[model samples]
Target chain A: MIISIVGAGALGKTYGGLLAQQHEVHYLMRSEYAQVKREGGFTLVFPPPQNSMQIEAPLLHQDAKTLPPSDLVIISTKTTANHELGALLGHCIKENTLVLVIQNGIGNEEWISQLVPHNPLICGVSSMKATRLENNTVEIAYIAELRLAPFQAATEKQCEIIEQAFAATSPAIPVKAYQSYKEIRWRKLIWNVPFSALSIIYQQDTQVLATRQPYVSIVRALMNEVADIAKADGVTISQEHMAKMLEATQKSGPYYPSMYFDSIQGKPIEKEYIIDNVLALARQYHIETPMLNLIQTNLN
Target chain B: MIISIVGAGALGKTYGGLLAQQHEVHYLMRSEYAQVKREGGFTLVFPPPQNSMQIEAPLLHQDAKTLPPSDLVIISTKTTANHELGALLGHCIKENTLVLVIQNGIGNEEWISQLVPHNPLICGVSSMKATRLENNTVEIAYIAELRLAPFQAATEKQCEIIEQAFAATSPAIPVKAYQSYKEIRWRKLIWNVPFSALSIIYQQDTQVLATRQPYVSIVRALMNEVADIAKADGVTISQEHMAKMLEATQKSGPYYPSMYFDSIQGKPIEKEYIIDNVLALARQYHIETPMLNLIQTNLN
Candidate 1:
């Protein structure tokens, strides 16, 4: 199976490197193209007990137009760059190719659906913690499940095929499929919207956000706001589920979310996908999200 | 009249310097004492058209216990230092002294009232923009009206005398006395709560908060919340007043509020008086202030 990973940042490189172990994986690169090509491939670093390996350079396409069409295209770009998706995906995917958006926040699937209307879109959120140490050097702190859901024309068979592809990797990247894409996305937001946003705002990590006093309360309020917005959008996220998410984050050991790193590096964040999208839905549903609204202001 | 400026910060120095031109003014000093004593005065820089002046060392006392009691004691300390007011004022004021609490935010008068129970407490908010340049130098950008209101047993006669003392200064510090302290505090909060708190958070000035989108809306939302809390607390802060406050702030030309500077200097902010007190009132009234609550979390 041929798989193409677009916008190969930290997550993109990690997932693409893993898939390259099992199948032919092509990385569409931009800034890191020269170094990655010079390095001959990505050096995948796994935590202790799990052996690390290097992926010898496969087909590294700097331009999307030069890349061959593949069975699956993973859109792991920071959703801030979703603007370039139409041109990138248009030049890379075939007529029934499955496009998996393993990105944070809401509106990615809708944006991709609009960008590449005919493709089968699979939207998923990865719990795996990965960081790009340098160009073509990907460090994996953990490999967790990639929860996937079919959006629009995505079928069960395609989902299963994608699941199997991940499962066959050197260290299996667990995959779970849900019936409702909205549920999974909002569930992810239950963590992402508050911790990701607040981590950047407070210049602190998940441990502080989850365990601190007023911050803990603010996180809860933000989660409640996200849940209310999700409910209004036809997705019900239970209080127990939100509590579990907070509990997991409290024990996540001062982890900085992708958005925090983006802010630290002075790069544009996925504020549009993660926060603005939720705000738009909240506005559409006439739900007042004052905390979310305040967070939105700070993002700018 | 003998005027004792309790906290000789930027505003304290400016006001004290102005009053020293006419009335006998004494400055109770702390951190700036040694430098001020060495210089033998405070250099007050007035905006052009008004010449800057040097206030030769009046009775600059480091120990409040050693200071002589005054007819009027102007409390211009950051509300964060309200803890020290009891000891400081206990040593510096006479039983019937007119204690003018020229500070920011709510609860200041209440706090001072408890501290020096028998004094005629005049609670006020100054619109003057003053910044401490050096140990004994204060640069005055603009000196606007000092809006005062009697807290508990402060008499109209005492308010008039205080107003006249300010009026008799070389360049008059205009003072307006309102009937209700709560009304004046809340009215001031329509500007202080949002601009002061957010300026610190964004590390930007009032101009950005006032002119920027989403932020402008946020400022409005915060103002509305403050007004709601004010209304619940029996103070009527009209929309027109809030709009005027925002408009004034927009034209204030990138001014950094005192809180912003305090944050930059790593000093504690007036979060308790400015935000937490309002939140407490909000909780008491059962009014939802999501923005204020979130701001409170960030202050910690």
Candidate 2:
């Protein structure tokens, strides 16, 4: 299957590199384009005893205008650049093309669906944690299943195909298909909103946020707020789910969320996508999310 | 009057230096003690256009036990070290000595009153901004009124004497004497709680907080919370007062609150006295202060 990965940053590179091993994967690059092209390809550094592999001379395209339409187009850019998606995906999205938005926060799938109205849209929430070390070097810190939910014209069969493609890779990337888009997004937010926001605010990692005294309480409060907002927005997030999210984060070792990295690197955060959207939903549902409001204020 | 300024930090040094010009002022030092003693005395650097003055060879003591019982004992330390006050002020605080706590936050005067029950205690909220360049060098950024309120056994006449002493200095630090301690502390918190807390959380100074978009809104929300908590605690803070606090902060140019400086310098912030105390009061009154709670959580 022909696949294209847009905004080839850490996550983009990691997933794109894996997919490139078995499928025709084309990388649409921006800042790292010249260096990646000069280096001929990129390297994927796996955690633990897993050997690092060089993804030699994968198909790289600087402009989406030049890239051909593929069966799948993975949008993995920082949501801060989601504005550029219209022009970036205009040329690559066909009627049957599966547009997978594997990014943090909510509202990206909706935004993408509006742009490519006829294309099948898929919302992806990845527990897979990765970071770009250098221009052409990407490191995978943790590998977990990427949860997929069909949005717009996307069918369950389309999600299955995408899962099978990932499963065909040398090191199979785990994929889980969920029925409800809102449920999966809200579930991901249960972890993302608190850990991502608090990590940046407190300048701590996920483990500290999950295990520390006031931080742990704060994390729970923030999660409860998210759950309340989610429920108001037609999704019921249980106490067990919140507990599981906290437990997973606690066992994930010390890991900095993407937003934390964005803040430290002086890059614009995914505040609008992750936080502002949640706040908007809270307002829409008339849900009182003081903790979430507080996060929004701090981020602003 | 023989006055002793404890915790000879920027505020301690600046006020102590000014008072030393007329009164027999002794500074009780800790980290800066050796260097201050070695240098003979500290230098007070005024804002531009004013000549810097060398406060030459002022009486300095390391151990409070060695110092004479003071007529007035000024506690200007970070409230994080307030625990050490029992030991630090034990020898210097006489039965009639006026113990003035010239520090940020709410609980310092209360704590000091508990420590030296018979001694006249004064709560001071200074708009004067200063920074210690070195062990023996303190710079005055903005000179404003020092608001004073009687905490325990403090007479109106005692406040006047303190005010008059400040007036006698070459560069007189303005002083305002208020009748109610709670009212004055809450009034100060209208500015301190928001600016100080937000300054640390957002990593921005007063001007940014006062002038910026969502930050300006946040500042107002936080101020409202403080006002609500104060009102519940029997102190009525007017809207005009909150506006005035914000306006003053906006006009103060760019100023980092003491708490902000403490945060950046890796010193323990005045969180206990400034925020936690306020939170405790809010809880006591059953006042909901989401913004304040948020600030407390971030600080933790």
Candidate 3:
């Protein structure tokens, strides 16, 4: 099996390492493009590693043109870089190869659907938390069995093969799948809309947002917008269940969302993916989203 | 005429210096009790002090017991520290002394009234921003002219004499007699609740709060709460007029409110005085103040 990763960030390296155990893995990193292959491979510090989660130094390549196509081409780039990387993978991907997008926020499915249409494209809702310690040391903060589902309603045998591919990596890494991935993704969307926007607005963590009413109000309102979008898109989220998720946010203690981490690094934010998509969809579906509109304007 | 000073912080020192020009002044400062006398006489550095602005350093005493009946006494302490100082002034004050509390926040007139009943008191509002430089120099940030009204609605020549005494020294500190000091106090109350709460909440200045949406919403909500309290208390506040005040918040850019300054020092905040007062009054008057309640709870 050949697994080509479209991102070189924390989640990209982690999943690539997991799949690399049984497959020939490749990475498309931003910095040190040449050094990745010069050093023989990329290193990812995983959870089990001592003092660091240094993952396997799998076969790495920056250019999509040089990669061998096989089992799957996973787009694990940040939401901001998804489209550009989608184009990069579009040029090299073969007809039979499936595409899986595992990134934060919405619109990754739409971005890759344009490139991977008619092929199996999996939408992943990853609960695992990860951070990159320097370039190659990708620290997996927490691991949770991922829920995988088809981007479209087509639950074909190809999707089952994709699940089996993830299962095969379990011996050397950890991977799992769920049939109810649509529900799970919508739930995760609920968390993302609130946490990411509130963190960016207050320049604080979930804990701080939970404690401050203005941030909490803003977070709740934005989450309602996402949940509204989800329902309008045919996924139901009850208010009581939503309140439970808000309660769970306090358990993360003081976790900074990935978008906030991006902000601290002075990197270009995924405002277009996180905020822009929800707002555009809300407009399309005629959803009332004053709170989301305010957040969207703020992001701009 | 001898003037006794209480709570010798910035405003206390500024007004103490202003009144000391024509009268023998006694400032009761805590800490360094001996140094107040040993410095020969305290020094007030009023840079570019002209246009009727004056500075005078008179006989200083640390304990309130060193004071006899004076023509006037000004309270210029941080609102959080007022409880202790108010009790101290209650125990060692002559009935004939006119104690004018030139401070921020509402409930000061009532707070002092409980301490010294039947005593002539002047309630004042001074928009003088002060910053203590290296514990030696206190620079006046601004003086939008000071206003003085009777603590209670009184027609005696007493208010005029107190204003005249202050004007004789500073010569430019205007003291307007309001038919009701509560109206003037509530108007000043508008300046504080939003600026202090928003600035302290975001840990930023007026300009930053005015510019951002999250902050802008929080500030607008807080202003609406204050305006409601003012209206319930018999003061009319138009929506357009209230909006202008928020715009002026940016105009008063970069100035750190006293509450924000106190938060920086880890001192107890006057969250109780500003927001809490508005909220309590609202509750008493049956005016709904959801935003003020949120800010008050967060601050506490």
Candidate 4:
């Protein structure tokens, strides 16, 4: 199966390189395409020492109109860049193309779905952590399950084809399919709302959020608020998941979330989906969210 | 009438100098006793250039076993020092001395009352703003009414003596007596909790709080929470007062509340009284104050 990964960030590079092991995988790069082409490809330091290897994944430029359409095109960009990427996806998509958006926040799938009109939309939330160590290399620091949910009803053969492409990789990243895509996104928000938003506000990393009493209490309140918002949206987020998120943050050590790094680097944040989306939903549900509202106000 | 002003910080110096205009006032100094004595006294720059005057408030050392007794002793110090000051008040209180604590926060009156069990207790909440500048001088930038309320019932003559002492000053700092001392303190907390707590949290001043959107929203939410807590405590903090507080902060310009300055300077904060007292009351009233509670946790 032919696969292409859009938005050449760390997440895109990591997954694309892994899939390139068994089948043809293309990376659509805007800025680094020339450098990667000249160098024949980039390298990926997969998790564990021995798994590291050089990857000669093919690179695709945005200007190439005659490029071959792939069976699957993964949109793995920051949520802030989703609008532009969506427009770009329209130019390359085929009738049966399965477009998967592995991004943070809510309402992203709907936006991408509208941009690419007829293509089947599959949304993904990955726990696998990766970093682009240099201009031509990415390091997969941790590999966890990658969950996928189709926004529209997907036939069994289409689902199997998607799963087979992932399973064929030399060391395939785990994938789990969900029935309700909205529930998956809302559940993901339980962690993202507090960790992403607060990491930026406090200008600290996950370790500090876990260890500090004040931050811990605040993070707890924020998580509970998000859960409340989710429950109002007809998705019941369990207390067990909230506690798991807190514990995971503590165990993750001193890693900065993407939002924190984005803020420190002076990039535009994805507040629209992460914070504003919840606020919009809360307003619709007539629920008061003073805690989330205060945080959102500060982040703004 | 002879009077002594304990805690020789700017707040104490400002009021002590004003009283020294028409009566003898002594200032009890902990660290600057020798310096103040060598300089004869510190100057008081009262509001409006024409009202500014030199003040020769007599200095007293806390170690002096035979300290002068006075008709009234105004305890004006940071709440952080209240514990030690409460112990020290026993050393200087006369049998009939009227003790007026011109301080911030709620529990100082109770603490002092415990130390001097029988003396008439009058609590004064001053809105006059002053700063001790370099070179041993204090500048009274803004003059507002000083509200005085008795903790225990005192004779009319006792109240008159306290009020007259303030009125006799050259450019008298206005003083108003209140019937309910607890109400006055809670009303003051409505302003102090948000400005003081947030100023410390954001590490910014009043101007930032006034101008910034999310911060302004947050400040408003915090103010409302305090008002809610106040209502639970049976003190009706009006919406008018809330608006007035917001307007005051905006008009106050770029001033750092004491708590913010303290946090920046690495000094111990007065969170125990400023934040904890409210939380305790909230707990008692079965009121949830996630906003104030979060700020308090962060400050801790």
C-alpha RMSD over true interface residues, each candidate: 7.4, 8.0, 10.0, 8.5
Alpha carbon lDDT at B28, candidate 1: 86
Better of 2 and 3 by TM-score: 2
lDDT of 2 by residue, B10-34 (tens): 8988998899878999888888888
> Across residues B1-300, which tens digit of lDDT does each residue of candidate 4 receive?
778887878888877777776777777787777778888888878766556667663755656344478778888778888778755675678887888887777777877888788889888888777877778888888788888887864555666677787788777767777777888889888888888987877767887886675577668777887888889877898888899878878887898887877788899888888898888888889876656756765676
Candidate 1 residue-wise lDDT, A125-184, digit = tens: 898888888555788888788999999798887889888988888788889998889989
Backbone clashes in model 2: 0
Best prediction by TM-score? 1
Q: What TM-score does each of the candidates earn?
A: 0.59, 0.57, 0.55, 0.58
What is the TM-score of chain A, computed separately for every candidate?
0.97, 0.96, 0.88, 0.93
Model 3 chain A poorest 10 in a row by lDDT: A47-56
Clash number by candidate, in order: 0, 0, 7, 0
Candidate 2 at A168: error in angstroms? 0.9
- Tens-place lDDT per residue, model 2, A1-300, is 788898888888888888887788888998888898888988999987788989898788888897788889999888999998889998777768888999889888878788889888999998887877855678887688999999998899999998998898868889999999998899889889998998888788899889876578778878888898899878898999788878977887998888998899899999998999998988898876656766776776
Task: List the lowest-lDDT window of 10 residues for candidate 2 chain A.
Answer: A288-297
Q: By TM-score, rank the candidates, best first.
A: 1, 4, 2, 3
RMSD of candidates 1 onward, in order:
13.4, 14.4, 14.2, 13.3
Q: Rank the candidates by DockQ, best first.
A: 2, 1, 4, 3
Better TM-score candidate (1, 2): 1
TM-score of 1: 0.59
Q: After superposition, how far is residue A158 of candidate 2 from its true place, in Å?
A: 0.6
TM-score of the second chain, each candidate in turn, equals 0.96, 0.95, 0.89, 0.94
The residue-by-residue lDDT of candidate 4 on A1-300, one tens digit each, is 577788878888878877777757777787777878888888878766547778764656655353458778888878888767745675457888878889888888878877777788888898778877666888778777887787754544565566777777767767878777778888888888888887887677878877775577678777777888788878898899889878978987898877887788899888988899888988889776656866876776
List DockQ, one per candidate, in order: 0.07, 0.08, 0.03, 0.04
Query: Cα deviation of B198 in candidate 4 (Å)?
Result: 0.6
Off by over 4 Å in 3: A1-300, B32-38, B45-57, B153-156
